[model samples]
Target: AQSVTQLDSHVSVSEGTPVLLRCNYSSSYSPSLFWYVQHPNKGLQLLLKYTSAATLVKGINGFEAEFKKSETSFHLTKPSAHMSDAAEYFCVVNPGTYKYIFGTGTRLKVLA
Candidate 1:
């Protein structure tokens, strides 16, 4: 079985500041990890993904995450925050099947 957890349910940051959204996963085998962002009433957009390729994966809008097998973590980070960046983020783990395990979700609030 595979599961994902988002450490924080909500994250607040000032515009132009750094952003960090933590995520952890438990999997029986090497798993495919992904980050997705969703604006209000909008569909999810793929941020980045790690598929046993690189430990560090970069995604759109200056977001990136590092896969740490030892720690069972894949925390997402951004150099700077933007107002448009405020959204709900999800960490997902694919167990190599049609089903995907998703984190509860993290809502990011960007303040000016």
Candidate 2:
């Protein structure tokens, strides 16, 4: 079984500052991990994904994540925060199946 846990329920960052959203996973084997962001009343948007490729995965809107098998972590990061970046983020794990295990989610608040 694979599962994902978002370390933070909420995160606040000032505009133009760096942003970090931590995520950890539990899996028996190499698992596919993903980061998705959902704005208010909007659907989930793919930020980045790791699927046995490069350890450093880049995604849209200046976001990226590093897949660390040793630590069982795939934390998302951005050089700077933007107001538009404020949203609910989800970490997902795929255990080589159609089903996906999602984290509780982290709500980002970008302060102006």
Candidate 3:
């Protein structure tokens, strides 16, 4: 079985500052992890993914994550934050099954 846990329910950052959102997971085998962002009243958009390839994965808008199998973690980070980045982010895990386990989600609040 595989599951995802978003460590933070909410994260606030000022414009042009760095942003960090933590995530953890558990799986019986190698799992495919992904990040998705949902804007207000909009659909979810794929950010990045890790499927046993490179540990370091880059996404749109300068966001990136590193897969640490030893730590069972895949935390998202960005060098600078933007106002448009404010939204709900989710950590998902697919364990070679048809089911995709999604986290509770972390709402990012970018302040001016």
Candidate 1, position 93, lDDT? 97
Residue-level error in angstroms, candidate 3, position 108: 0.3
lDDT of 3 by residue, 4-29 (tens): 99999999999999999999999998
Taking the tens digit of each residue's C-alpha lDDT, what string does model 1 give over 48-91? 99999989999998999999999999999999999999999999
The 10-residue segment with the lowest total lDDT in model 1: 93-102
Assess candidate 1 and give its lDDT.
0.95
Superposition TM-score, candidate 2 onto the true structure: 0.98
- List candidate 2 segments past 4 Å from native: none
Q: Against the true structure, what is each candidate's TM-score?
A: 0.97, 0.98, 0.98
Candidate 3, backbone clash total: 0
CA lDDT of each candidate?
0.95, 0.95, 0.96
How many residue pairs collide in each prediction?
0, 0, 0
Query: Residue 5: error of model 1 in Å?
Result: 0.8
Return whichever of 2 and 3 wins on lDDT. Answer: 3
Query: Model 3: what TM-score?
Result: 0.98
